[model samples]
Target: MVFQNISTNTKLYVRKGNINIEVKKKATGDRIRRSLGLEDTLSNQALALSIQNLIEKDLSINAFDASLDKYIDKCIKVTETPDDLINLTSLWHKYIEFKRKYWSPTTYANSGLVFAKRFSKLKNQDLRFPQKIQQELFENFSLDAVKRSCIQIKAAINWGLQERIISNVKWTIPNKAFEQLLKRQKEENDINPFSNQERDRIIEAFKTDCFAREKGRHSQYYFAIHFWFLTGCRTGELLGLQWQDIKAGYLTFCRVRSQTNVGEVTKNSLKQQHSRKFPINQQLSNLLVSIPKSKDYVFVNKVGKPISFSSLITCWKRVLSCLQIEYKRPYQCRHTFITDCLKTGKLSPSEVAKLVGTSPAMIYKHYLGAPENIDVPEL
Candidate 1:
């Protein structure tokens, strides 16, 4: 059976055992058809008729949506939703499928992959009960890991609720519990930049292959290490650099290369800003001129491919270990540069923040703290 609203240019019918609606705009002469997600049943016919009436009323006022987005969720059956048996691992995968498009490669690498791995541990635990999740997390993981898992699980479950995926599950990890856990973890927000002497030692170690002489691998990233100290750009932004990004008077710091499951992919743009130009001084110009043009990338590994963050960190740790310098991760090169710029009193916090592609607020918050050693002035 078919129901037609001739005056409104609308038709309601069943095709392939599913109810559908077709609307034609009289002014534009465009036809729009959509599946209503309802099985063919006598009771569903009445509901479809009511929806037709609503669409006709909306059309009369020129308020009908041509895309049919407003009606898409009306047919979601609450009784068909996932129940208490749904596990965190399966639900997390579904949530990722819904959200993966909007995330950057860096976000996926840093947060998404870590959350997915942690959530995989709860494959047998039901997602609907907070007690089970809390127990599993605490029993299997460390305190820090449990806290992180709770935060991420809450976020995922909230997203699932908003999307109508798990309608039966209302219980979530409590906020009071999270606050209690947070209180137990001591916060460490102080900046740990390398000293000038240590920085020079690490750079020389990489340049001369002081650590990996037999493998001859550390020397290939010598230019990369030097560039990080000089410019203070993030690892992804530095790795994304191509020969073309170098201008005559300035270098363009744009784009980011982050590693994902498939391979290395470029993320959108630099954080907080689209792109910025770094003025090329004589020192930077000399460094650029010295590097041989082996590939399109200004930096490459021994095999002449773009440098991956993992590979860079592997070389970084080896160099720092060989030099007997305290290990601060590769990002300290950026911190070291920013701290040195501020300590010189040559640039204000705003200037240092601009040079490092960050905000002055961050500089004041994290970088403005007193150094580890400050000698008292003679009065």
Candidate 2:
């Protein structure tokens, strides 16, 4: 290829064999060319003169030879800023904008966006200070919360590096800190399943309470509690249940309803995506048969909508208060069921996992230590 001065203005030409390629010099083009130690001038005549000087110098050297395209690329690299050197916040914003199209609103709020806001002050800082941010988060938040934040931050950083929006660096929580956080979570979340006596008291209280039985009042509260205790379904899964989900002798857990800041949203699949059939016991089957199916849902409030989780918890608290029983989350019904199933010795850990749309590892890890042995001899 041979460089040829075609015009006294901002245009030049390179002849490759019979083809002449025209190259225009814009302000950006001139800057790039200058950064590559080539000619850059205000007027086209001056720029042409500078190019002529370069050509004469190259001829004199008889060693330096490169195509105009290759020289332009080299100039671009010289003038462009490396992605890794961009501010941390700028990279996170790019990541967040990209993720907004793909992630659910609730997930974005709960994970990436939330982490972004928490560390907004450090947005202008470099990603090299990830360890410092991790330490700060661990000190300020609960172990679980910290773990979640770290995961989001790490994911965002990894994505930025992968997309070449930021530099690759070690942005992981230290192994020791992560292990300590896991230990704290395990210690804090130690399963506290209700005993058989406590379970009996709760059921009996709910059944006999006048407030629960009040005509045209929270009557569904009574049945809802019973349904939860009977099925051991997650509160959201039980509330999400529809009349159509009930088959002849089993119920299909295919969806879950969770309340978020905006409103309630129904996920089409259960947590862990482990939707399964839960066989209805004789008592529960009888109870289902007796209830009037006035709405699409198996359980509904007075306004004919699926019962809210808060309402269920309020009813449970009232019942617990009436019975003078100690407070336990409504979720303990699930633990109670798993413990009862394990005590019966009729179902294996894997079987219980299938029944509740959970993992066998979870069942054994949490419930196997104290199986309800009804046959144990009295002291």
Candidate 3:
């Protein structure tokens, strides 16, 4: 076989009757040679030249490792394989870049930031081995973190597959695995709703700003704190509420305002739904009617700005601590509402779910059933 020089640093020659391409890195003075495993025919010569051209292009950008790995990966066959065209980290960055424009700044900060940081732990790992990812998530992260990271990883992988950045394989974590992860998370972070007595005392404390260094008794955010329990709105949704949302004995929830790295961003929908409307009962109506409509927002701070969740959290913690009530997150306000509704036996899980912008499955799974309180009839 005749030896041929394709470029200054690359040459194709025959070794043992098979075509081989050799590359010499000028900067590192390193020599690399790969066998094309083709016979010394005219067709094989053409293929060798083509491969040489690709290597030259990749070497220009100092990406020899990536370039050669992809070529070799394509040539090989195995039961399970690693994709060298893109790794898990690169896929996540590309997927997030493609999705950034579609996501709200808040969504990007809350989800995009967290997922990106956590995924970095699996640096340069191929997406083909989902079990490795599952193991890392379960062993290294908290149960809730593991669940959320798994969800984000799966979403990014699905996007990568659709975009052709990932090779088609059994790369997805199975549904049973996800269900088990969720079960473990639920066990770790079970819903601990405040009892009716505890709920009432907490509300009263917030209303009076009890144990506050600066007292604004029933003046600052009393209505909002009360509203959280009565309507089961999320803290971000309550902060995003406008007076226009209330009309005709119903409140429309279609926006969320939350802090992000950039700043506060407004999303035109609930976290999971596009919108949800909560009916106003007599008690809810009284609370809404009594609050003065001086500001655009139905709930605002003493200085007439949208209430910050951080401030709300500080107040909630203070009230719970001072009142000697067991500490539950402010989010438990929603749990208490859901539990109370389910306990009444009047509202079905689906009805309660719609009112709270959640799923019936979530209601049934987290909230304990009323039968725990009711006496069983003798058979």
Candidate 4:
């Protein structure tokens, strides 16, 4: 499916089951709509409706003094702004470009991965961020997108607002949309880690089954799963480990690659940047003893190449298919570990937070579930 509009700068297309959107400032290819997230979901008459609505709304709005091109240019130049669309888009581009320059190869891949599959259904969505009753409308959109795995949609939308593609006033359609999205995305991205039974099944599957056809040996899969399961490390972190990083009875994930893999490997500063340390649990410790690690990476592809996070996911998906288990992701292991710990006994939220490399407050808000009801003896 391909969407082309002579009147609008945005063009959407599908390639190999993935949506690729290319936005031009005009037909001549001066690009403005760098955010292609809406590419997949905007097709056919839906595309016309989306463009018509935005254009109509922009014409109607009191926020911008000018049209789309003038507004976008002003935003890129960072002049005065009365709307969220210009400001938000400006920040979004800055962060994304920065991430590209600073993040690791693996870190960079997750965004693209999520963009492709999460919003694959978004070929044609009515993206007219409702003007009145905006708060209510934004919350509903946020809740729906989160469940569908398009949590970043709101953030990207905010960027559009900041850039002045959308209005930018506080409590305006764009701003309220941003607020609701951030709130809901956090709530929705809860860790439903693999259960004990599922964990056991994966471990078993890795040990016994051989997929990928090319690799006859199951040793690598077994070790990778065990390592990921035990540490609750991000798939890439587990795959990214070097022999040198593993010291006497400890694995230090102090230096994680930035999402882009463009800069030198260092601590992650971005929310997406993950730099956490995991203790040497029994499972990992015992497994480490048996495996003869020769290369820099603890986990490698069958070719003995270091596994990037995306590559690990491809393998993981295959593993899940083989085991016939409901597939989440390797990150779910970390979620499982966190939730599992909370269930066992009372550990200070701060203590658990430190181990997981997040705030204690975050633990309770997202993961602690409901508070316990204490029983009192009748007097």
Candidate 5:
């Protein structure tokens, strides 16, 4: 049953299936006071009009309905109440908290928290406003910063849309702007792998140098460098490897150790979830056999703990300095190995990808060059 009181300025009270709901009238002075619990000394009309303006600004509602429960549900669905307005900062925090369950500590700290903090300064801004977002991007951020911020902002907004905390809206970086960023990145990025001669020189230095041959720290550095060049495994994967992962002729890359802001953390799976077995060559086998298996990890530090990527990099830099080789990051070892494998012509592109735990498409796009020997048909 539904009925309205003329004295109460069209306020409707409905009762259906034992549910009673009171639908507010046209936000009158007394109604505003009841809703707000304001002091009696204030001008009721002025306060009511002020509240009406806020309601008009924040909410979109149809005319008052006879069904009070339906009206209340509709109000809950839309931004009809002050509490219903989505706070961008709050939503971002919620998104980050939700993502922590799935994302690694490094990812959560670097991407999720970084974006949340960046956007939190604009606390109450409506993320649905594209112009405001664009203004924020330009005013306070550089081009590179804008690109990174956009990635996180877009992800958070997509999550909000999926969770129904945000209204569906077109939020995207324009194609032209993104293209410019890509151009900038391409200009900045340089992928240079060591040549065969350079690889040989580096290896020889690691093997023969008196400092590298010394008992404790030097031995660990030498072994790590040789293993990296021979196996083409990522530094994290190599550090994460356990003695049990090594079998008769192959080593399984099933886990990774990454350095997060907190410290080093071990993940049970590799990047891309592509665990693969790499065959051990003579050099690698000899190195493994010489080292004592005192710890679960194949590679460890002075205290018998897993060595970090940063520490490995320090050792690599020292070796490079001693040999006077042109500076290259340790990751170049992976690239060098891939290039050498491709140049040999013994392994196909698919085989290289399988060994490396990546896709054939990646090998073709990034590592493989033109064929050296294409059979010509006799005409």
Candidate 6:
């Protein structure tokens, strides 16, 4: 594969190859080529940063080279300076594009979902500011304004820094802000794993639905939830599971994919490397072997696509209602796994982290919050 100094040419004969962007802007040679080093989020960021760097170099008054200048000018067309720099939406869209280009398909979708929920509010709401984008505007916006949105917002801001859209001069958040938000969120929700009795109740309730769907669809959902509890895998990982991924005592998933409704239907997207193997314990392995490999989805709807989150919601609500048990959340499976692991010492903190695809610090912080009342036996 080869790359040519094609800013001078109207058409680029694109092929399935990589580009190497590390070399200093070379003299307008006959050809220019580079390689894309990796395919994950960090790698994508690297590629975008490299391109952003080249553009910034050209932005400098003294920076000049005919071929590179022409290339940079063309990039400027798609990557435009916003008429309203202070507007967060403009900055977010640019960063979203960058994120889409660099992040894994799953990460891109997850980030977009988070961004849409967290930052889209107050859209087009005017925050009067300098006609020119001020780095200070971002530096000083009340952290409260972006608390829930901060994680992804910071990602976009950091991208802006790389692209030279926002200088790092006064653009920084309080170092402790993110940590606090996370700590608080952990305390409030996402950690209440269901108790053993409650777990059994849900299981029994679902299994009792003999006529559900007049077929096996409801049973499949029940089985999928069981798999989620047993494996401590994310909902997506469970939904995206393919029978082909089973081998020996291991079940594999690349990044698990999920669907979304953003006015249009989204499809299964593996957010993490779904190829990683999980211990297909004797029971899970045997159960998997018995189930017919009828569809590509490990868990599908009646129509045979991946199960919608709403499916679980409806099933869970009815089951909880029938059992007369208080409802927590469908994600309690994850929380339950964490608590169970901690109490039983099935795996050490670090080991649990890898198995669950999160950090030890996160596991401890998000889980292990004591219940309001301690269980004590009478003396």
Measured against the true structure, the TM-scores of the candidates, in listed sequence, are 0.69, 0.68, 0.68, 0.53, 0.67, 0.61
* Per-model lDDT: 0.74, 0.63, 0.72, 0.53, 0.62, 0.55
* TM-score of model number 2: 0.68
Write the residue-wise lDDT of candidate 2 on 67-163 in tens digits: 4544344323322545757544445555766787786645544454445445543322456777677667667777777777667677777887788
Which has the higher lDDT value, candidate number 4 or candidate number 5? 5
Kindly indicate the candidate among 5 and 6 with the higher TM-score: 5
On the 0 to 100 scale, the lDDT of residue 261 in model 4 is: 16
Cα deviation at 217, candidate 6, in Å, is 6.6
User: Where does candidate 3 clash, by residue pair?
Assistant: none
Q: Which candidate number has the best TM-score?
A: 1
What TM-score does model 4 achieve against the real structure? Answer: 0.53
Per-residue lDDT of 51-73 in model 1, one digit per residue for the tens?
56557767878887777666444
lDDT of 6 by residue, 104-149 (tens): 5455544653454233333232224321222333454554444535
Residue 52 C-alpha lDDT in model 1: 61
Candidate 5 local Cα displacement, residue 211, angstroms: 6.5
- What tens digits encode model 5's per-residue C-alpha lDDT throughout 244-267? 999998889998888653346687
Deviation of model 2 at 254, angstroms: 0.3
Candidate 2 yields a Cα-based lDDT of: 0.63
**Model 4 lDDT, full chain set:** 0.53
Candidate achieving the largest lDDT: 1
lDDT of 3 by residue, 107-145 (tens): 666676556646655533566677787787778777667
State each candidate's clash count. 0, 2, 0, 39, 0, 18
Candidate 1 overall Cα lDDT vs. reference? 0.74
Task: Report the poorest 10 consecutive residues by lDDT, candidate 2.
Answer: 40-49
